[model samples]
Target: MGKDFRAIFWKDIRMLVSGKFFLLAMGALALYTLYVNFGYVRLVELSMYKVCLWDPQGICVDGSLLLQRASSREELDRMLLEDPDGVGIDLSRGKAEFLLYRSTPQVERYLEDYARSLLRPQEDFKAEVLGAFTTEEKQRREITCELLFFELSAVGFLGIAAVLFREKGMGVLRVHACLPVRGRLFLLSKLAVFLLSDLCFAILLTLLNVGVGPGLAILPDVLVETVILSLFMALIGLCCALFLQDFRQFTMIYLVIAVFVATPVFLSANTSVKAGWILFHPFYHLYMGMKNAFFGTPGESFFYYAGAAVGIGLLYMLTAAAFSREMRDAPGGLRYAGKDVEKREEG
Candidate 1:
């Protein structure tokens, strides 16, 4: 049994490598690293929102460096008209008034606080550092965590499905049914291959983006959560491969998942956006777990680990059922009649 499993495992690895899976993985690693260091981090560092002030009477005393000084009220109005996204303050009357193209409650709160931060009593306000990480470290951890999640949940999942669907289309999976190997070995082999690939991707992503010292400190927790997510996603991909008839159908479903399902989770977890029901979304917590792990703030909840185990178990069972069904139905269908000729001849 061990030998058969090993043979099947290596075969899948060879197939994956031959298909340039490793090359794609390396390309993704390099691209993601460049994006994090050269693109995302720079954007985060330069997020100081532009503000225009029209305080002709000198009513405002806020010393916020983010505030842009206007020589005259006319100049401020002209600037605000030119840049709609810029926050504008008008002090025409004795009382100060805020002006902008639009305002959300969140944006209003930010503007009001920012205005207050520039006031003379700066001691009354305090800017707290949320974590031990500096600005650069925070940026590194946030982008690295998000990229790791995307690679494992979406990209890595699709890669495995693409590979399996190739075998399925070529009728190779049906041939495995007749070999003296355990049926589950095929499913297990794919899972193992994808799990290893995902873990390697996570490590490289963390190290390249977060710096080796910090990444190593949190790698164990990150890898634990990664393995759980990877296994679950791999099984899902396998299930999709077995059940979905074509790549086009699978691509549609993948699109829905990567967009609607994953987008809300990212919004709720990373940004200030809050949804009351987000706690029910499994990936939300998983994403939080990863973010926390990246910042060396791993969640100690037993429910997280337990839920992951249960999720992985259920997904594996579903994939196994689908796999077995595929094998069973393959030999009896007209589509498989030509391929089953050898099976009948052997019988």
Candidate 2:
């Protein structure tokens, strides 16, 4: 059994290598690393909010750097009108008042808190610096980690499925069914290949984008999370490929996964917006796990691992079942011979 599995594994590896899957993945890794290091990290570091202040009687401190002083109330009102989300401060009545165009009430409250915090002097605050990582380093790691997670979970998952479905369509899976080996070995081989690819991608991505010292420090936890997510996504892709008739159907389903499933989890995790049900979403936990790994906070409860184990097991079982069904259904139906058979065959 072990020998057969090794043979199957080697065969899969050969196929993957010949098909240039690794080469393509290498290209993607390079492109993503460049984008994360040069593009995404820079974009995230630029703070978006503009603070416009209107203070009459020169009551406000002149040296305050946070406030962008407006000449008059009319000017402040105009600035606020132009950028409704821009924070506004009015000091017309000898005391400062915060003004904002109300969009989401939650966001309005958040802006108020932010405005107040900005107005305070640095000497008044005694916040601890948790790590020596600079803002740029932190941003690099955060976005690099996110990009790696996305590449493995979604892009790599789809790539593996596309390759597998091509073989399935070519009736190659049926040939595997007749071989003197466990079908599970065949499935395992593909998973092993993709998992290794994803892990290597993660390593390179972290090193290139997050710099060597900090990236190496967090490598173990990052790899742990990468393995977990890669296995889960590979199984999912396998399950989908085994069940779906063709790439067209898989593409449709993948679209749903990309938009409705992954987008909200990303938004809620990275942004101020919080969704109540994200606690139950598996990807949300994985996303947080990756994020935490980047920040050197890998601690999570036992339930996280337990849930991941359960999910991976369930997906593997489903994929196996689907593979069996596909094997049974390959030569689905037959018909009698005639001109009718010829016409029917043409149709």
Please name the candidate that would achieve the greatest lDDT relative to the true structure. 1
Estimate candidate 1's alpha-carbon lDDT, on a 0 to 1 scale. Answer: 0.82
Error of 1 at 195 (Å): 0.6
Runs with alpha carbons beyond 4 Å of true place in candidate 1: 42-45, 51-66, 79-97, 100-103, 267-277, 331-347
**All candidates' TM-scores?**
0.83, 0.87
Q: State candidate 1's TM-score.
A: 0.83
Report the error of model 2 at residue 139, Å.
Answer: 2.3
Total backbone collisions for each predicted model: 4, 0
Please provide, for model 1 over 1-347, each residue's C-alpha lDDT reduced to its tens digit, 9 standing for 90 to 100.
Answer: 88988998999999899989999999999999999999988876635556777777787675566678889887887887777656777767866566776566666777655655554336664444366777788888888988999889998889999998877766777787888888888888889999989989999898889999988999998998899889878988998888998788999999999899899999998667778999999988888888888878786599888888999899889889988888876632444456668688999
